[model samples]
Target: MSYVLNDPAAFADESTDGFVAAHRSLVRRVPGGVARTTAVPEGHVAVVIGGGSGHYPAFGGLVGAGLADAAVLGNVFASPSAQQIYTVAKAVATEAGVLLSYGNYAGDVLNFDQAEQRLIAEGIPTRTVRVTDDIYSASSDERQKRRGIAGDLAVFRAAAWAAEQGLDLDAVAAVAARANERTRSMGVAFSGCTLPGATEPLFTVPEGQMAVGMGIHGEPGIGVQPLPTAKQLGELFVEALLAELPDGVTSVDGARLAVILNGLGSVKAEELFVIYATVSTELERAGATIVDPEVGEYATSFEMAGVSLTLLWLDDELESAWTAPAYAPAYRKGAVATGDTELLTDDDAAAETETIAAAATPEAAEAGRTARDVIVAIRDMIDREADELGRLDSIAGDGDHGIGMKRGTVAAARAAEAAADAGAGAGTVLALAGDAWADKAGGTSGALWGLALRAAGDVIGDTEAPSAHTVAEAVEAARAGIQNFGKAVVGDKTLVDSLVPFSDGLTARANEGAALAVAWAGAADDATRAAAATADLLPRMGRARPHMEKSLGTPDPGAISLALAMHAAASVLNHTTAQKEES
Candidate 1:
């Protein structure tokens, strides 16, 4: 559906580069994303906002004087890596601190929390406030479980305003949290979005029907209804938001609200204004005062025919913060004063070249080469199966799983091959591969895989070749890392569904004194069976939870991909065994 792209995998990066080029005066290139070109005062808290790339003006386009000081850009519909977030935060951080803000999504939460910990460990004060404003995502009582939508604008603006006022990190974080709590949003989609190079959209609504409560990441809506006129849609938006006011607000009457009528891509400004026309009238009829109503694209899905409405119940402080001046590529509010600017000298620090160490012995070097071969097999397998995996994911998620897996495995394979050529040990090879996978993939699966690989590598050290027992132990370590990091159990219908069985099978075979190849083959079989079993279960975690019923007949994409990787690794080990037997 994305017609004007060379390689789908490179679209996010290429688009970011072009964006930076176009907004050179307002923003400059940073490691993970973009930062303001203007100067900031010393001891002022820096407000850093980020999410996936599909939402224009939300992340990159909001980097300027009164919005975000920096924005971390992730792959399309994928959260950025923790390393990327840390790099971007460090690039914009001042003596006071840094406040990392983003939408409330699983991947974003995991990576941002990791980055927050790393920043604090290095003595940089860092805080995070996740925006949860989509009223339809969850029941009002379960507000914390709600997803963030177009309400990101209000939260980001409030936080940035507090920062611009020279507030410390804690104060800025409080403002962002307050903004999130006060904001409520709901959306509807007439159609779904397609990923680049994909022949079909992720999901589609029937003609003359619309999906209500759809997500920005190509997730299908919770419910469907016949499409209505612009006026009827506006009434729907106003009625839904007013049904439940934030805790502080007692009544909708006399309530001052900051309204955002956001077009979720393909719904142009004129169409939005037509909807806003009715939305404003409805709000006024409800006896609520609208303040600075925004009618345009703020947070968007790639070419999704949808619109979301956000209402921020403003108190005195929130109103003042909301009215503050801002200047950005996609958003400009009032007059913003300028100052002398200087380019970041440490921008190139993120580009430091990696050097692989020589193995301690020839056996370790040979093991590293074997690891590289295994990674290459995994990469090839993913390339072959990506489309099917993505199809499964599209049933309940953003449908980027296959592409994400391919990106990770390809990057991992390259890193593994380079490490093996440098005579690195198996441990170093796997660890470097994991880092590359995470850095390039940038999603929930990417983070988990990278962590699992690194954990396994840590157990297998760089000193010597691994025995069957050592390999089993390493696999167990990997399984443990995934469970601990992702917090998913077997029935959760995640990759852990397959990984746990595979790990247990490997440990059992190794304990029975089986050879590495035989043990791995048996474990791979277990993983394949476990992956297939997931088709009978409903997803209880991650992005698929909201659409659990839709995924009932399909296996989790993560589980399938893990099983495929396990089988690929087994094939490599079997080939090595065969070669040894021949010799």
Candidate 2:
């Protein structure tokens, strides 16, 4: 069901080949999985970087004309060997000497130290800069043992720029060491990632939950806990990071800091920005000035769904370099213009455009009069089956699907009634229903339903009257939008299992000249059947996939609910059409 590259062993080789090929002009591959800068200055200080492979742009991609002189790459979730370290050091060393900089993982420390001795024996000067910026990694007594996270970017970038500017080996190493001392990062994962070729995920978290302080290599986190809202999570990260800062430390010239919000893959940009908004507010309250901030997937683990926040206590020198001109496929430093202007006139402006209005035309009013009874009937059926749905989800999912569906539908029905009373258009009524579902439902399902409703409403915007065909087209468009945005397919064991079939059946019936109500009712039946049939299929995505075997034989709650809603819609359509014909 999930379409992923089959050969896991080939991941490292394939990825490295593509990476080097793309940046061949700026970087060169050294022996032992190490890459070096192609345009190293003759006597400039050398900067060496290294890390595990999956967190690209950290260790390898940063090697270039203005960045690291060399980078040693490791296998996925594994450390590079000592030989790999030595190979890179030898390739990039100069009389001015090489400064070895990398994360604080145990394997990295051992191998890098081994390579440091080897380079020294060869009469090539080398110094080590260990980065240990993860606040969750250890207590104050054992801070040196903490693993590095996004803070490595700031350390490496600052050190490399110093080296590029002709700082001596000791000076460059000192700058990097200072950056590590002042920086700290913390993260939480919504889900874990699968290693190449591994059918099972590396770790697991309970559904509808998250693991705080999870390591990059799928290491067990502090514990599984309720997933926080973006704002709440941001606050947690900021509080922890600030607690770790020294009492009197200020940015260079006594300013505050610059923040880096690094996505751990699969976390969307919108979510990251939401987190950033919360973080900025917290920083302001702490009397810290954030000179600049970065938000994006700068470091990742294949497709892990999480994010890490890195805070750097900046000096004027570091600030300049942090803002210096640099570019790579995955990392860049650029200015973003901001002004003291309000983008929205009011809080409602922040709501989706389709959410604010709810009015139906005369034709839609008639349609809703018929549809209202059907919706009530379906809602009653869902209320009756709530226990069964919960038990099924408990086998593999968070077991909240039933409750979420019940709440969403109840809210939607109330909104629909409100729309009808307001004499709103059909689309406006649907939009209101969607807003209700979104507001009531939590987690991914709520977001998906909200998006689907918003898309459908946009398509039917301001229509004075709508026929069955128009309603069908709008629903089809909404379904397409859900498919586009959610990237879900029929066998993903999502609502699509029911929705796809329901939409197809409805369209087929409509094409064959069936009345809208009759066609919709038939489609609803097909959806329910399809969803029941899929009980034998394993879920292939989201939190349910980790418990795939358990999920088997349990129909997806979202799918079942979707089918129920479609059937209800069909019944209402048929009643309205019949009434029209009689009149």
| Number of backbone-clashing residue pairs for each candidate, in the order shown | 0, 10
- lDDT score, residue 404, model 2? 53
Which residue segments of model 1 deviate by more than 4 Å?
341-350
All models: lDDT? 0.90, 0.71
Per-residue lDDT tens digits for candidate 2, residues 63-140, read 754567677776555556555677667766779888998887644665576678879898888999898887776776
Which clashing pairs does model 1 show? Answer: none
| Candidate 1 lDDT by residue in tens digits, 1-583 | 6879988889999999999889888888888888887656788999899998889977999998889999999999999988899989988788899999998888888788889999999999999999999988889999988889999999999999999888888888998999999999999999999887788999999999999999999999999999999989999999999998998899888999999999998988888989999999989988999998888999998899999999999999899988888899999999988656565532543655777899999988989999999999999999999999999999998898998889999999999999999999899999999988988888898888888888888888788999999999999999988888778999999999999999999999999999999999999999999999999999878888888899998999999999999999999999998998999
Q: In model 2, which residue pairs have backbone atoms overlapping below 3 Å?
A: 251-255, 252-314, 252-315, 359-424, 359-425, 360-423, 360-424, 360-425, 517-573, 517-574
Off by over 4 Å in 2: 1-6, 34-37, 247-254, 334-583
Evaluated at residue 275, the lDDT of candidate 2 is 95
* TM-score of each model, paired residue for residue: 0.98, 0.56
Report model 1's TM-score to 2 decimal places: 0.98
